[model samples]
Target: MKIDATLHYALIFRDMTTEIEASKLVNRLAYEDSLTGIANRTYFIQELENALLEKRSIGVLLLDLNGFKQINDQFGHISGDEVLKTVAMLLTKSFPTPHFAARLGGDEFVVLLDGITRQSQLDESIGFIKTKEKNFSVLLGEQSVPVEFSVGGAYRENGDTIDELLMRADEQMYKEKYKDRPHERNSFN
Candidate 1:
């Protein structure tokens, strides 16, 4: 009886340790961004893949900062970093819940919209981003400068990979840039 009790306790301890380790792994993957603190490309891709595999219709918005080179040229790389951070903050605030946002790299950001069953919800989200209040200021020498973004979005369909979806969204973003706008650029500039 004593031997059986000892074995039972040992098994339970091992199981508990395994559970704790698994939990830690998940938390690490979910919370930490591989590149930036916003979110890692893997996390974004996993979320997108889950949504797609679940047959849940969703929207992907890819945003690239136009005139980012101008900011870097005029101010410096530090100012460019400020712009990326500010834009990341804006994206986090804009799509507060139910939407996953991440920085793919450099000046490119992507948003994955889950629980979007209707086209109107997608439209509303797009409109919200379009008219979103972005009042970020950067100190350039002695003066403060402001910046804005031109965004584009695409809906996810069947038979789509992560790259395909992002490319499609990027294409839409570039199309939006082509429209006559003050803050718009020709491409992912």
Candidate 2:
């Protein structure tokens, strides 16, 4: 009778541990992007909000791939997914820890760089991206698919909210995304 009671208790503990692990896996899947294996948009926004609440000086970067639709149309989604993964890899390698990158579905990605207390820091990041912007290319069959992107960076203003910072960075990104192509993405039918 004693051994049976002990065995029952051990089974109960095992089941409890399994439940805890399952819950943790579910929580992680909720915030992780399936394709690129980076933080999804929801998680990224939460982190940004947390940073703002902590009053951390941060540089918000919005990156939009230019002509992404064309790439998908020409190379199918496999090539597109490959390009997206490549972009995520570069962002992770470029930023490292504390600084994070997230995918906003489709071809849009966002990066948050903390500890940008000076204008020089922002400028240096801009320079780095400008230098590396042309280096993203993927070999797709016989043709090499070039991954072109436009980046916008904005520093937090006094009493600025996350939405405002995102808007500013997005506007800056659009400026570059539509620099020469006045046709734009939405009305290019």
- Strongest candidate by TM-score: 2
Model 1, stretches more than 4 Å misplaced?
Answer: 1-36, 133-136, 139-142, 181-189
Clashes of each: 0, 0
- Clashing residue pairs, backbone N/CA/C < 3 A, model 1: none
Output candidate 1 Cα RMSD.
4.9
lDDT at position 22, candidate 1: 94
Candidate 1 — what's its lDDT? Answer: 0.75
lDDT of 1 at 67: 77
Name the regions of candidate 2 deviating beyond 4 angstroms: 1-17, 182-188
Q: Give model 2's clash tally.
A: 0
lDDT of 1 by residue, 1-189 (tens): 268556433343334888899998897777556445688666788788888888788888888777788899988898788778777888898887888789877788888887666667767777787776355565666777777666777677678777787787777778776677636453364
lDDT of each: 0.75, 0.85
lDDT of 2 at 47: 93
